[model samples]
Target: MRKTPARTRSTSRSRAAVVAVAIAAIGGTTLVGSPASAAPSGDTTQFKGVNWADPRDNYADDPVVLSGLSTSDTYAQTYAKASRVISAFRANLGANTVRLPINPYTVNGPYWKSYRGVIDAATAHGFKVIVSYWEGTGARKDGFIDDPATYWPMWNTVVKAYKGNSRVYFEPMNEPHGYTDTEWADLAVKWLGTYPSVPRNRVFVSGAGYNDHVTSVCADPRLKGTYLSLHHYGFWKEYATYDQWVSDLKERIGNCASRTVADEFGAPMTTGLDYNKATPDNNSINFIQADTDTFRQLKMGSVYWPGLRTDDTYSLQKLIGNAARPWLATTNQSGADRLAWSWGRGKPVSP
Candidate 1:
């Protein structure tokens, strides 16, 4: 999983009359007492440029409340759980986006048959799938995958499942955060499987340092076809010293790839609820707070970490993008990279 966003402090709100007019004109909805302002309506179009998993409703702040997770509890049950996850967020059911982090075990293990089932359900719903996976979470898994060389096979299989579907965007890994250029060389370019008309170009891989995709690893020629990803949080102010924090966190990527997105970023569960109590007035006003705007402009697309946790994470979601939170229209698709989705009616649920 990627790091989440930080929470913002909010004290007041505009009059009910103002909210009414904004909602009516913009098809508006917002999180209460959050930075009160305009919101894009349900008619707010979904992700524009790339298609990946971002069903805010899935376990966060979506319209349709999602259910079932026993299958995802363990690798043995991954196929079963993955099936339910995809089924729960079907596209035709009004779920246009999904966050399917590919489970290599379930995809290549004995339960592999069930992995295909998830893809079938995705096609049924018309979702623009984002297939991401988490590997050993280490520098590299040097051993050859003899038991399950499912990498190429999975790609070919998933692409074929959609019947030449263009909505699917394959993300190779979750956080290749600390990897060297050579580490990604194999997955990015040299693979053993055949294409079978599948588009390897659609497969995206994370860059270095968690989700700092553009700054660290997007330069490899082998990674020519894929996009980059980034992650940040509004709470950075609470931890690091401003002198060391602001400059390091503000890694500028003047434009490296065809597309780059803030895969995750938001406040913590603790701060969101008592944000006013925790974040100092001075800290809140620091440059760390500039992330939202800087990211919105630099990445061109952003998806805040979910405020809605498996339990009640609204404390955190409120600072990100939640209809219940009432922040600006700077979510799944409201701002840029062209992929973020907005809170809307009939949207699926997060948890």
Candidate 2:
């Protein structure tokens, strides 16, 4: 995940300052249009989730990272550490789901022996897990997997492993940025057919362009019976207003509200900031609030980008303490509050 600078402080200290000035200029609500509204589904179940990333595995290039990185003692210790992290997610953020980033090479190979433990623990703790493939130790760490020869077989191994497990989900690929809309749609259709045993509803078809847009994928008639996965970040559109941000998101999502899920979206949480209009320009807080509002109102599920990516500021929660019994701390209070709010912890925000 890439990092972005914090929102710039405006000349006016309070949001009301901008509000009054803008209102006087516009004669009414300064923020003009509503987002391209999705027809809301009566199903109000919100998917409050976070990406529980591995601190070490994301950087590994070897197919069998577990054996390469850890000895017997260390392997057991790492498994124990993951349990604490999952517990923290449940205890603090009330995350009902976790988007697990996987190195296709490692997971499909020897690493699966150890990785399955984490998936099982999350399942036992009652968190829906979406496992996604990332480029590991290859030609380019560009977040695009172009080698179908190696890619197809790796996913075949992954889908086959969890074909019977309803709790564990199979995301064909993380973000298919290499392919165009039609190409990616074709691949998604092929994936469903390849693994007929794995139910289509359990599969997550990623949006085109780094999982940033879903309109094309949602429009595809062939890619049905699957949920859409989207990844949006404050860094994507710096200095965008809340309305502009939401409008852009709505445009990408198009009409697939009920079937779409924001599997990845987040911003810097280490900086001390509240998710409000006070820090308007380029603020992650504003991003969270606007996106959270959309997710809740449209009844679409949202999973935060990273729950525990070691050095990543986007991580909602970080691991502290020893490897034996790791402790998790909330990186950003206001950011976390918005997540809880999206999950229905407080009063609902009207659309």
Candidate 3:
């Protein structure tokens, strides 16, 4: 999807607030901007995290879009550019966790009506928010073909207009192709039994195409679940080698299922622009150091891409907002989703 507002928000919000004030001006820290960032009242174990990008789509004007306008009369400029990309992605994600896919033609409700105010500022940014409904066609809205029981009446109207109480999560479709592996285990056991009390670990599913060589669609056994949410961009180029994409995503889901999370991979954009501070030379920083060494070998939870502005340079915080250069953190901020806990790199203490 592509958005516009004088071309993707005044040219990608002046180049993503200058890469969100240059990531607190090059990691000196203490740089916070707000208009939002307050929704995680607590517990979903604080949604560990993933979705740097890939079906984690839309950037270049930022999320909550109405992109490339097809006129219903540019639906109020695509609902004011999806309410300013979900209030600048829930104001730089104070806590963390985001993921948002759902509309492969989601029963065509106007692409969830301009993606409902960026899914209501991503559950107000306390993100446990996964809401992946995974595309429509429950056999023409409900007789069932591969996956779609009209997503339980469109998640009862998108989990009651994003008030889905408990911080929300559901990765129903993605990487999903035609279907097989028993029709992806009968549309995830008929949409995980249409939310039989939501907590089978609040819904999670991943694997279809980059689903690390298909380890049997969310490892069915009639769909006993917890979390597997996987997808791999196979080291985004450089001819593979980030330990062979984390040793083939840990032998494709640790020997056929259970405990996965990798979620997604790089988007490719940061080519040369560390704004002179130097040293992030560019060309996908070797796929951002192979996604920071596969998020420290799957301590998991990551999210990247041209979150808002990009030319080309394997965006993982645009080389940390261009090495936090000259003060700022907006290569695209709303806390670039809190530097994804720098992917467990000797940070201890807590995520």
Which digits, one per residue and each the tens of the lDDT, describe model 3 over residues 1-351? Answer: 111111221111111223333222323222121111222121223344433232223321122232222224233444444344434444443325666655434324665665554445455545555666433332222212222334456666765554346666666655444343444445555555555545555566666443444477545555544455665442333365435544655665655333455554543333333221212333333334544455554455544433433223333332122211211124522123234433452322211
Choose 2 or 3, whichever is better by lDDT: 2
lDDT of 1 at 143: 17
Residue 29, candidate 2: alpha-carbon lDDT: 22
lDDT of 1 by residue, 78-146 (tens): 334444444333321233555454544445554445445445455455655566654432223211121
TM-scores, all candidates, are 0.53, 0.81, 0.29
Question: Against the true structure, whose lDDT is highest?
Answer: 2
Best-first order by lDDT = 2, 3, 1
Task: Supply candidate 2's per-residue lDDT for 164.
Answer: 79
Report the error of model 3 at residue 150, Å: 17
- Candidate 2 lDDT by residue in tens digits, 1-351: 323223231211112223333223322322212122232244325467887655553534654222112423344665676667788888888888887766656665666677776777777788888887776543454445534556677777677677778888778777665455655666677666666667666778898757778888878766666778887777665577778778877887887877888887887788766674345665566677778888877777888877777766677777677656777889887788787776666654323
Among all windows of ten consecutive residues in candidate 1, which has the lowest summed lDDT? 57-66
When superposed on Cα atoms, how far off is each prediction in RMSD? 16.9, 12.5, 20.2
> Per-prediction count of colliding residue pairs?
39, 1, 37
User: Which runs in model 1 stand beyond 4 Å of their true positions?
Assistant: 1-67, 72-96, 109-126, 136-156, 191-196, 234-254, 269-289, 307-309, 312-351
- Each model's lDDT comes to 0.39, 0.67, 0.42
**Number of colliding residue pairs in model 2:** 1
Of the two candidates 1 and 2, the one with more favorable lDDT, higher being better, is: 2
| Deviation from truth (RMSD, Å), model 3 | 20.2
